[model samples]
Target: MERSWTQPVGVGVVTALVGFTSSFAVVLAGLQAVGADTAQAASGLAVLCVLQGAGTIWLSQRHRTPLTLAWSTPGAALLVAAAGLQIGWSAAVGAFVVTGALLAITGLWPWLGRTVARIPAPLAQAMLAGVLLTLCLQPITALTVSPLLVAPVIVVWLGLQRLAPRWSTPAAFLLALALIVGDAVLSGQGVTLLAPVVSLTVPTVTWTAVVGIAIPLYVVTMASQNVPGVAVMSAAGYAVPWRESLLLTGLGTMAGAGAGAHAVNLAAISAALPASAEAHPDPRRRWIASTTAGVTYLLLAPLAATLTALVAGAPPGVIESVAGLALLGTLAACLAAATADPGERLPAVAAFLVAASGVSALGIGAAFWALLAGLAVRTVLRPRDPRAAEKPRSGRHARV
Candidate 1:
């Protein structure tokens, strides 16, 4: 049966939009948090989009599978929460470079990948959940500043999430957009367009950025984004080569960081969109949707500056609120994943609390400390008797 182009093209466009509107604000805010000027921030967005799109296209073609590439959303949140106002942007860029290099190593070396896999998943997820805790407060905080503007956006987001789950994020983004632009137009102060300009920055490596940003960014990108992204494709029955895909994204991340961008990685939520039956009935043909989505990303590249300008022009409260709303679903999912095991609850909770504390020492962010603290507590609290492991099996046999 010959496949029609309609589904592939339509799904591709939708997938592109989902990738863009969902986390673009987080990217911008992350860049700004690290001390990016408007030009640098816009350039980072442009470079990130291009690299993600290019990487997706290349990987999908090379592997003959539907592969979706994306920037690390959780990593962006890490930046927002941990971009030590003192470390400055150059050091952040250096951290980004280090992260990319680490990602590449994970792909190239089987031992490294296995070692990363050994990191207790519960602790990793708990750390991510804690990192996101503060940003999740934005919507509520925004209400105190401008309820009239924020209330409607939140209502629409919540309403659509139940009514049309897939469209909820885009709808929320649109509502926020309307409010931001509408206010500008009505007040006789029209929104102005700013052309994105690329400005190269030589990254300055520091112990602070290496410990505080690079390590955590690499961890979250791997655990929170790449791991689930692979699962999404595997669930859809696409035999993806995880190592090669990681290598491509890691290289792309390196290129992107050269232009002030952060990590590029595998798509998690959006991956299934292009790989699903909706994209194409025949799995082999689904690559068309991913490639088309890549083209759409390239097309949208020029608008990165405008998007940054829009975000910059909006009130801080509104921007934070929108970002918060965007991440609510992710936070819930992370929390659930972190606590999935009954036995790991204590360690996970400890990680969560420490991460949520937002403490930094000698420039290292709280997320790292949280993981360390959780592991230490888990070790101390664990049963030292070797026979403890046999008790569970014995109980099961007795029941049988």
Candidate 2:
């Protein structure tokens, strides 16, 4: 009763397409924001893809789990925000190395891992739910921008979700690809292929970049990406070695830093693609989907430049529609998980609102702030249920 390669392969292909199509442009923009020239940006993208691809392959196989890895998209956004803080891309690279080392150290230390585990599940889900809520609205927004292109994509997705839930994401993804490629063909652009150039720069450290860029990158990536990633995997009933996954991703991040890429970590949304019913019915066999995704990533490394160009030139609404459509299921699940605990509803709502507001305090992103606010609210305004706990009686104390 071995599962056929068909399911795993389909899931793998879906995961890769969604992963790359969703945020690869953001990554390129992040590099350019930080003063990376064309070659450096292309190299950074190539290195990141290769590292995550190889890392995903190794980790999923080693643990026999569906552990897909990805670059820190939130971290990329942070870099984009703090682009002017660093002198050059070299300084950013230094910060990247430091962030990776910090993650590696955290993995080696059981206390830190335990501390992360201690975070309330509701709060974690709230943060993820909040982040996804904004992005998941892209379909509606894209409709306003280009109804002809986006409306059909959403319709196709909804239809597939009702008729064949497992294939909805992949089908939507294939349709988006076709639409984009078809547009290119009609416009006579014809899917131009630009070879990726791999360039490495020696890292230069600056205290400003370390404090401003490194700390924020680490915080956001861990809170927004890795925490939700682990939550997604766990919810899917896959028991992964959190410490090991962090360590491998940390090493990969360091390896890619010199090539101008920032941190890499566990994926939140894309990981679900490989772990869902689409991958395989048997949980034990789902690892193949992640492994296949890794192979797909490796194959796409050389095409980073081309992919980057395609996305950059394509209609903005189209890209957003694809990403938003792919994340719809994950968004719904996160929302449900966040509100499942009635006792934690207030704090979770607070977290969700703050996270969705896209606020950044000082240098840190809203996700960290949301977590802090939620915990504070939960502690200060402890909602007491009369049936929950009882004080010891005076008579019992006397007897003791």
Per-candidate clash tally? 0, 0
C-alpha RMSD values across all candidates: 2.9, 6.1
Task: Name model 2 segments beyond 4 Å from true.
Answer: 1-45, 60-95, 188-190, 199-243, 260-263, 266-292, 383-400
Question: By summed lDDT, which 10 consecutive residues of candidate 1 come out lowest?
Answer: 391-400
lDDT score for candidate 2 against the true structure = 0.77
**Candidate 1 vs. true structure, TM-score:** 0.95
Tens-digit lDDT track of model 2 for 1-400: 4456888987897788668765675577677767787778888899989999999999888988889999887677556556544458888889889889878877898776556656777777787667666657778888998788788788888998899875676677667767888888998889878988878888887776677677657766777688889899999998768788888888778888998779899988789988888798888889999999999999989987776666666776876676667666766776787787666778899988987776765645566667788889877755254333243332111110
Q: Using Cα atoms with residue i matched to residue i, what is each candidate's TM-score against the true structure?
A: 0.95, 0.74
- Give the per-residue lDDT of model 1 (tens digit) for 52-118: 8888888877776889899899999988878554688888899999999889989899787777777
**lDDT at 319 for candidate 2?**
63
